[model samples]
Target: MSTMDYDEHESKFMRKARENPFVPAGMAGFVGIVAFGLLKLRSRGNTKMSVHLIHMRVAAQGCVVGAMTIGVIYSMYRDYVLKPMEEQKALNHK
Candidate 1:
């Protein structure tokens, strides 16, 4: 693709990421774990590649789940805790 096309695609991706940050977080986690798993694969002496693949799959899934959990907690905190505190402060000022 041309530079302009690449930039446009990236901009669209960033816009989507901003709208739902959890997707990027989960993607980053999965990519990071997979990369790490690949790097460590060569050192596995006497271990089957299938076993390593299974482990990588599990770890990547865990990363995505962890990201989702964190996102939910943060959303809850913003909605339940921060919003109420801000509303209270506004009431106090009035």
Candidate 2:
């Protein structure tokens, strides 16, 4: 293969493997489900919110709650998962 063609192919592969800078489809669906389920409980037993509005409102609430939940969990995770490793590294470096 020519050098230019190889470079182009490698670049294309790298681009394909790159992380998406947006919420993924399954994660988005989970957020939507949680938000919709939370906001859909109305005063009337059988009433339902409009489908589009339910999804929209839930998605917004999902973004807010999801961020907060993630932050809390990440803090716990770093404390439990990384703090010991950091201390160990410090000890070894001494």
Candidate 3:
């Protein structure tokens, strides 16, 4: 793709990320954990690559689940706490 096309695609991705920040957070967490796992992997005497792979998979899944949990908490705080405060402030002003 050309530079302009790449820029457009990046912008679209950023817009989507802003709309739902958890997706990017989860993706970043998964990628980061996987990269770390790959870097740490060593095929030595008693260790199996399959076992390491399974551990990495589980860690990545945990990262995604953590991100989802945080996202839900943030949504709840925004809706239940911040929104009502804003509404109350608006009512006070009127």
- Candidate that scores best on TM-score: 3
For model 2, how does the per-residue alpha-carbon lDDT over 1-94 read when each residue is reduced to its tens digit?
4556445556653543332223343356567667666665564365555765565666676776665576567677778989999999999999
Residue-level lDDT for 36 in candidate 2:
62
Which ranges in model 3 have alpha carbons more than 4 Å from their true place?
Answer: 1-10, 43-45
Model 3 C-alpha lDDT per residue in residues 1-94, reported as the tens digit of each score: 3556445556777866875799899999999999999888864347788888898999999999999899889889999999999999999999
lDDT score, candidate 3, position 56: 95
lDDT scores in order:
0.89, 0.61, 0.87
Candidate 2 runs further than 4 Å off: 1-52
Instruction: Per model, state how many residue pairs clash.
Output: 0, 0, 0
TM-scores for every candidate against the unseen true structure: 0.75, 0.38, 0.77
Model 1 TM: 0.75
Model 1 alpha-carbon drift over 4 Å, by segment: 1-12, 19-22
- The window of 10 residues in a row where model 3 has the poorest summed lDDT is 1-10
Q: Candidate 2 — worst ten consecutive residues by lDDT sum?
A: 16-25
